[model samples]
Target: MKILILKRDKLGDMLLTTPMFALLRQHFPGARIDVLANTYNAWVIDGNTDVSRVWSYQRVKEGGRIHWRAAFAQLRQTLALRAEEYDWIIVANGDASHRAIKRAAWLGGCNLVSYTDAKNSHRKVNHPLEIPRQIHEARRMANLLTPLGISLPEVLPPLRFQLPAEAQTFANQWLAEQGLTPGSYITLGLGARRAKKQPTTEQIIRWTRHFHEAWGLKTVFMWTPGKSDNPMYPGDDETAQPVLDAKLPWLVPFRGPLKPALGLIFNGRTSLFPDSGLMHFAAASPGGVLGFFAETDVSPAPAQWGPVGPRARWLEAPKAVSQLEDASVFAELESLLK
Candidate 1:
């Protein structure tokens, strides 16, 4: 059997579907399970064992004009996929109106499974499942497999992100240079998609001191690597500067590519982050993860997108994350650490 799973989305969204890949492998051990991921999030599944192959494509940014060369390349890839004659094509994204489902239908798969909402009631999905109003994204992805007799477990497995051997080596060397060892420190990610979701510099300093005094663990601060002015992918250079300027010996600053950064997070005792891609990466690690999310009525609740794992925990503030009291934040941290 051959299957195609479409999850060409953001980093967090791609990570959420990892459990479904594992379940598919277990159910059909010999089946070839491939994934259609985008260039941005394909790294999440680089070393994943369950996926037979990963096909990646670039996504044009919203409102950006599509280049002819890129369009032709996409068309070629789509035609190739249609030729594969997959037994099943599952649109693993939670959104009912995701364009990937329409592409799946065009692929002429023998069986197509996807979500159906009021807006997408007419989409051609052979096995249509209504989008669940209240469920973790991982569970929502798992629901797509029900048509194949794969049932959701009471407890979904944690997100999966395997570090490559090279990255592990780099992490080990970097830690040695800094006189640190695995599980001996904590990581604090300083980047969030929106500035409002991040904790203030003073708050970060307080947290660092608290962690050091309470538990002898040093803190490693990681942030996005480019200037905020970059049009393509704005980063947190300005946001991280104040914390870095403090020059606290115990507060190590890290700015690099995603893989090595992930390696460092995986080796830490635990990690703290705002609601961002790094938070999702940390959730996949063996160490505990704590995420601070902003609550907004217009967006999906933190309960849906927040980290999911035995060791993952999150706190939500009604307005901006700055509104969360230090006492409440520390209390949640105490519970998570214990």
Candidate 2:
């Protein structure tokens, strides 16, 4: 069967959806599974084993979000997707990706698309996230296709991607050029979809340099577009923007493709990121590690959002072991050095 999984979100969001790719492969065995994502999130699946193809959509400005241009692109993609005669199209987004699916179906001539009718957009779609049983977003996606008489073993599937041998070699060469080694390095995610979701800029600087000095961990800072310039994605709409928008101006303006941000999470020794998509990617990578904090907690104290499985040790704190106190994080990072 031909399958299309649609996920139009940030990098980490796409990464989480990837685990479902593994599950789909196991259940269908011979299905031709493909994914549709925003341009920024497209590369996350570049070397993924389970997915057979990728389709990318442009991230448009809020003013012209679903304008004629977007409509034309959607129409074209949907028409192409229609040619595939997908036996199933699982939209991996909650309400957010549903919009894309609706457009695609309108354009593609396939009306039977599935996605999490998530709380975030339930009112719009008016469809409850039924099959997935309304659990984690990842689980919900897996649930969507389960109705098609597919089920995998009870064990959770993993998200994975292989660096092209040359890419791996190039990455190693890049590391060597920086005089860095994997164990002796710490990577910091300096950008987020929401600026308030991040630890302060001063915190990032202190944490990275501190770890470098105390643990001898070389540093890598993930950068996004116009971050130093505008520092925030021009939000949903100025009037509809979250009020905290005024408080967070130092973050990345994030108008470029999100691929670079997703790419940033893979190499870190431990990530200090909020509960966003990159955190999921870092947690899911072959041997990835992260320090995750909950975005649910909006306090000034940084939260640690780490890998949830054997590959990570999730750290949650009002204890203040932050990306700011780099020296302290360096000490904690020692355990992962080997």
Candidate 3:
């Protein structure tokens, strides 16, 4: 049997789809399971044990005008995907838009599965899975498989990713050079695509001081690679400069690919994040996490996208990021670390 999952979304969405991959593996251990995701987020599934392979494509920004060359590239990739002749193609977490559904069906599959709300006419999918809009995104995705007679697990599994032994060893050696080791340091995942949702700059410094002074754990500041001229990937180097310049001997900066970074988290004590892909990475790691979430109209709420793990906990802002009190968040972190 062959199955393909279309999760052409960003990092957080792809991480939430991990449970669906787990379910597919449990139900059809012999089947080959593949995923189609955005190039930037394809790493989320790179080391997934349940997924057989990951196919990637660049994501065109929504509402941004696409040039003819970019459009042609997407078309060529879609045609190549259609040649795979998959037995089942599941469009996980896509809406009922004509463009999205059409692409899912266009991939040349015997059966196409996806979800729809009551308002949708159900014209886009061969297997239309109806579900509520407000539930946790992971559970909502898992429930889509019920029509196939796959009994739901009583408890949803945690998000997951795997790292090679070499990667772990490299991380350990690097930590040793820095006078650190597993379970002795914490990572602060700074920078989100959406900057408004993050705590104020002042708040981060205060929080770092509190963590260092109270928990007695060294801190690693993490950020994505970015250019100074481009706004698209404004790396947190500028944001992290103050803490770096403070000459606080306990802080270190990490900037690199997701795999080794996951390795670092895998060997670490705990982490704090402001609703970024790093939160998902930490949740997948065998470590603890404290994720701060602020209300946003543009994206899903924290209840729907917060970290999921036995040791993972999240704090929802009382109102907005500007109004969030750093003291309250530190209090929550104190409890989690203890």
Clashes of 1: 0
Model 3 lDDT per residue over 164-279, tens place? 67778779888888888788888877646555556665776777777788888887777766754465556666666666677776777777766667778878878888787778
Q: What is the lDDT of residue 261 in candidate 3?
A: 74
Q: Give the top-scoring candidate (TM-score).
A: 1
- Prediction 3 global C-alpha lDDT: 0.74
lDDT of 2 at 6: 72
Best by lDDT: 1
Instruction: Residues 179-216, candidate 2: write the lDDT tens digits.
Output: 66654555555444455445564565556556656666
Deviation of model 1 at 265, angstroms: 0.6
- Judge candidate 2 against the unseen true structure and give its global Cα lDDT, from 0 to 1: 0.55
Off by over 4 Å in 1: 60-69, 121-123, 229-231, 334-338
Q: lDDT score, residue 8, model 3?
A: 69
Cα RMSD of all models vs. native, in order, equals 2.4, 7.4, 3.7
Candidate 3, run of 10 with poorest lDDT: 115-124
Which regions of candidate 2 are displaced past 4 Å?
57-73, 96-98, 107-128, 131-134, 152-154, 164-174, 193-197, 200-214, 223-268, 294-309, 317-335
TM-score of 1: 0.90
Candidate 3 shows a clash count of: 0
The lDDT of model 1 is 0.84
Per-prediction backbone clash count: 0, 15, 0
Off by more than 4 A, model 3 = 56-85, 116-124, 164-170, 227-231, 297-299, 321-327
